[model samples]
Target: MKILKLEKGKLDLFASVVQQFGEVHAPTEHEGKFSFKRLNSWSEARLDYNRTVLPPRKYFLPPRETLFKYREATGYVPATEDLEKRVVLFGVHACDIHALNILDEVFGKGYLDPYYLTRRKNITIIGIDCTPDEHCFCRSMRADFAETGFDLFLKDIGDHYLTFVGTARGDDMVIATGPLFSEVTHSDIVEYKRRSSQKCDTFKLDLEIRDLPEIFELEYQADIWEELGEKCLSCGNCSMVCPTCYCYDVADEVKLGSHDGDRVRLWDSCLFATHALVAGGENFRKTRSSRIKFRFYHKQRGFVAEYGRPSCVGCGRCIEACPVGINIVGVINRLRGVEHASTD
Candidate 1:
């Protein structure tokens, strides 16, 4: 990996050079939290902010999209929205980047999802290393560090930002930034490693990943599901905030008394009562307890069985967004019979 160095004060200038390539989408304040938005100025984006309210996955797989447009007289037509320019998704956290990689595996496997792939192709991900907050547990998931997926990865080391060129896109970006970046020196390498070590020690949350498979399998009928289900409001906030939740439903949305319409796909949450309902009034996951178990098992067990890794990156946005204080780490800890699991 090639390394480059830029002083902290010159960050905006570096972003300006990147802006020449494409529109820059970076973290900015929405209300009380941060989110990715098209920036009018590089300074508007917050490199030091906590995790965004929603993951950056939205850029690749939007909340809603029209699969195809239909007209009674004309039949069916594909409807692919044109995003005019390639995008630079700047300052994405490591966990969000990891989540995006997980999505690539899901969508790019056999029958490639052209809709998501096109958007993914257009984005040049520039990841920024983050110091974990109390709510973050990415370390436990082995998602705190990323080796691929990002075009450029930045880690703060005192007055300078140490950057890693992960791909040709990253090399191009660095070249575009030009004289602003200098070659990394021995001292810079030393400082970068020192800072990275310090950053790893900052996370407070931990999970029992060793026994996760056995715990998940054995907990198929565990009493914890009942307790969690009762507390679950079915608000769907957890799924919405999650970086890796890709569940969705599709349908034709036609105008009243008109045949012209669009076949749209919308984000769907298993937490919804009617999510699993089908024709003949049959519902697979009708009970709240069953739904709760399904959601947890899918992330911890089912995903592992398929992907060789858990769907959860331990970003902990679910824990922060939950109105009832239900967290996956706490659940895993409790299942593993950790002494202070509940209190944690």
Candidate 2:
């Protein structure tokens, strides 16, 4: 509940102070696209970025991570990240925050993925509000706002920013650098509310959120997948840009003529034809249509059964990344219409 005002002028100084905690990773533009990268100074960070090409999850769950390294004679050693090291992730959006929470639940619930969870404990998240574009649909997925799960949430209030403290780590940072912040003014409160409330109107997604799960359920047998299969190139660009897609494939990389090697976990996708293939060449989701259907169903329906909610935060990165313009909202809406026809 701790909220402090950071004057627009002192933002760089504040970022400099925060950088003492760890390396600051923030949005930076290259070739007219935004992506998160390690910053040398506070000035290099872009808090006003529209969206990052890849979500900050790459810091936690890397695209390629070594699970363990082994030797021919020796057993094996875990090749996890440096758990003691800290990194300050700055300028994360609301949908990405929800995506992180989903990963926390997926990895922390039962198995307690030591590698991911340990690194998670060492990192700090600093979320910032953004101006949604036509592709943003986090509002429909109820991920447009986040009050918890992050260390600090930043809101732009015209002249200054309101930093809402969500965790003890965030509060501690503020308390340690007490001189950087000032008492919140009455004007600040009014402006923050005005901006946050009006942000909803900026999103362009017009999907029916509640009925989407049922539509996906009843339309499991729908022929819409055929259309998607035809449109989809199976390049896996959608899953790569997605903030919540966690499918991975494990491989053992061996040295030439030696038994010593490293077991690595690489990002995987259901769109790949061989994702469901086994040693004996048994492919369950063999058809392109079936793979396309499984991806949508897994995100919208199967995930609900396991997590009590759909996994999609609806940031619409997939929509923007899809080469053939296979939009998630359009897909869901099509299923809704097809399901209605089936019942009738």
Q: How close to the true structure is residue 1 of candidate 2, measured as C-alpha lDDT?
A: 91
User: Each model's TM-score, in the order given?
Assistant: 0.96, 0.95
Location of the lowest summed lDDT over 10 successive residues in candidate 2:
335-344
The sequence of per-residue lDDT tens digits that candidate 1 reaches over residues 234-336 is 8899999999999999998988999799999899999999899999999999988888788999999999999999999988899999998987888888888
Q: Which stretches of candidate 1 lie over 4 Å from their true place?
A: 341-343
**What does candidate 2's lDDT look like per residue over 261-310, in tens digits?**
99999999999999999989899988888888889889999899899889
| Model 2 global lDDT (CA atoms, 0 to 1) | 0.85
Each candidate: what lDDT?
Answer: 0.87, 0.85
Of the candidates shown, which would achieve the greatest TM-score relative to the real structure? 1
Q: For model 2, how big is the CA root-mean-square deviation?
A: 3.1
